[model samples]
Target: MEETKDVRLALYETIMNLVDAGIHAIDEEGRTMIYNQKMRDIERMDSREVLHKKLEDVFRFRSSEESTLLKALKTGEESHLVKQTYFNNKGREITSVNHTYPFYYKEKLMGAVEIAEDITKIERLIRRNHEPHTGYTFHHIIGKSKAVSEVIEFAKRAARTSSYVLIIGETGTGKELFAQSIHYESERSRGPFITQNCAALPDNLIESILFGTKKGAFTGAVDRAGLFEQADGGTLLLDEINALNIHLQAKLLRVLQEKKVKRIGGTQEKPVDVRVIATMNETPYEAIANHRLRKDLYYRLGVVTLLIPPLRDRLEDLPLLTRHFIQKYNTLFQMNVRGITPEVLTFFHSYRWPGNIRELEHIIEAAMNVMLDEDMIELRHLPMQYRQSGHYTPAAEKSPLLKDRLFEYEKQCILEALEANGSNISKAAEQLGLSRQSLQYRMKRLGI
Candidate 1:
């Protein structure tokens, strides 16, 4: 038997009949070397079905941000109680509480150990507590801006109260993070934090989901708790509250006023004690002007209002936000990138970032993957459209933001220097009759 087989056998003996869920071990190359029997059962695989398969193959639904195993293998840091989900061969999905730690051999990278605790029961409760506005893991939050700091501080305060709270911002801003954080910090931290996307559900389904249904209440009805009752003694986040239709809005207004709900087929009204946090991606004034929102409901939910600033207004936070996403994908892809070069950083700084923090993250992740061992991502590493520093092309007018056109001129200069010097920056500087210091200065200014 191979060394891994021996290790797996040893691990099995150590964990025989332990009801703490499953355990898995992976090597530096992401190959599984050892796994407990419960893991096999949960994955619906035999003990020896897959002795050396890649982790990516087994856990197909891993989060896009980062994987626990990858981070431990690369950084040797222990992941403390991260959460994840997996599906068995029988197509039964399960939630887990994960812990990852690096395993070493002679101080060198060797393998990693994973312990996952089944949280299906806890997840059900969590789903309820995660009322449409429950708190989020730190990973989902994207900014380190001073303005964001203010939002976090105020949210902590609002969470302590049972009064209604409203969040207003442009689309793509991270309002959900605030909503979730509030619930987590509140008195019901251990309770369910449930959420319902008011706009995503149809009118008939909306009422059913929020107020729930009696057994045989409607078509294919099953006795169920709605978001309000399910989130009893906790919180609920109603996203895009303005998108709620008029009829349903009236029912929602009652819940806000009376703090009670009656299931569709139930006779009696049940009192509820659920905090409501509503979010809108548009300003209240704008929604009012468009007649998309009900002013009375808005005022009731606006007892404590929070405004999330757009990414454009907080450009200083760009570098930190970029670094966060880079670290995330680095672990995800098993890439060991030290850092982004000044050239790449410059390109990001000058750009308008129309999609805000979200767009910046996507761009960085894309550029990193396209270029290998790229210590300094140059203009060439960027999308062709962004390589030209804001210069006017036939397509300039149709571009999305002001920053795109500005980079065009910088791209031209960098290209001219590289070409004249046979792609050598020093030689290019000499050809341009510029001291290398002057050339470097220009590059920094232009973000080339």
Candidate 2:
């Protein structure tokens, strides 16, 4: 009878191995009793290496208290199609959907069996077809200063090439916006353009997401093309590339050199036609010194490097940018706001915008929201931080006499009244308890 039972168990294992999906069954003690070839391939493990090992010993679960197989066995509950993302023993990340069910014989509980399907391929396909398109062009970039114009010209030249490009700039200096413009203006604009932020994902996952993965390469892994393949024949923007670790940087350099990628568990390399554009928010040397970015990879990607000028360095373009944003917000908010006050412009010029153009746009949009029927943006609508800086004040040059200060204050009140009254001299004068002629005379004398 025991020999017959052993033969039956071997037959069951053979049948399970023939199935197309990953199948793993553990005894009541969580020891691997039946792990098929497909499971070995899905996990990129040798069947002989893991056949008799305990589940926890093979794959380190976060905690024994939350083990999925353990829970299913103990509670006699079935876990159906639970999607999970985790790292295997070798530190390769795997994303898969699993179904864990309790095994039983007649009325006697046996163990737990799990069936898993890797979804990495499905996700890549979805991203390829569903990613949003970038609609910006060179004309959308607003700048006229020599410093900015030079950067724009260089970017246009870089866009025409198929070589790798790198953009260096401070945060909020529009690095990604410039990248999008490059893609839209390039010859490959008709093809798909995909973007991936290197710093946004963890190191183990970023590599698989970039270079693709092969079946049996890691636990719960399936064959799938990564971002490189997804962006084939198009542009691939790797934002914050310095965030990738050194080990991964070496791997990336290989891909760039060969123009081919071998999936994490794949043995054969696949050729890909992709134009890469990398962006760095910090100085490249700093990243190298900190050991975040590899020097060789930097040389490869910096073939067409473009550095964007910060707002402070190109103050000459502030007026043009201000008008651009004002018109932008006017149409967006459906308001006919004319322009900003001269006092506000003075403040904008004198103040150091640490956040660059992004900060300026925020300030303008916030001020526009509070216009209250006034056609022009005023000093009071400005943020308190800007107002407290005293940069916009005429008193910055020299303190005025008491009479002169009073005259200036009176002039400001008259100007505000006129603006609030829709530039009606009679209404403004009435609000100020004066005749229209008196208000006009004050305006002329004070240069309001």
* Cα error, candidate 1, residue 250 (Å): 1.4
- Badly placed stretches (over 4 Å) of model 2 are 1-96, 102-130, 390-448
Candidate 2's displacement at residue 129, Å, is: 8.3
In angstroms, how far off is 102's CA in candidate 1?
A: 59
Worst 10 residues of 2 by lDDT: 393-402
lDDT (tens digit, per residue) of candidate 1 on 1-448: 6999999977767865464567888998989887777777656677555569877765556466466787798888988567777664456677776778999899998989888776554456446544344246444566667877777777778877887899887676778777887778778877777777888757887788889889767534557788898888877889999898867877898788888899999988999999899998766655756877765576567767787877766767777787787788889988866667787766666666556666767777777778777665566766767777562123222323323332453356567767777778788766554457866876786776
Q: Positional deviation of 126 in candidate 1, in angstroms?
A: 11
Q: Name the Cα RMSD for model 2.
A: 22.3
Q: Over all chains combined, what TM-score does candidate 2 have?
A: 0.63
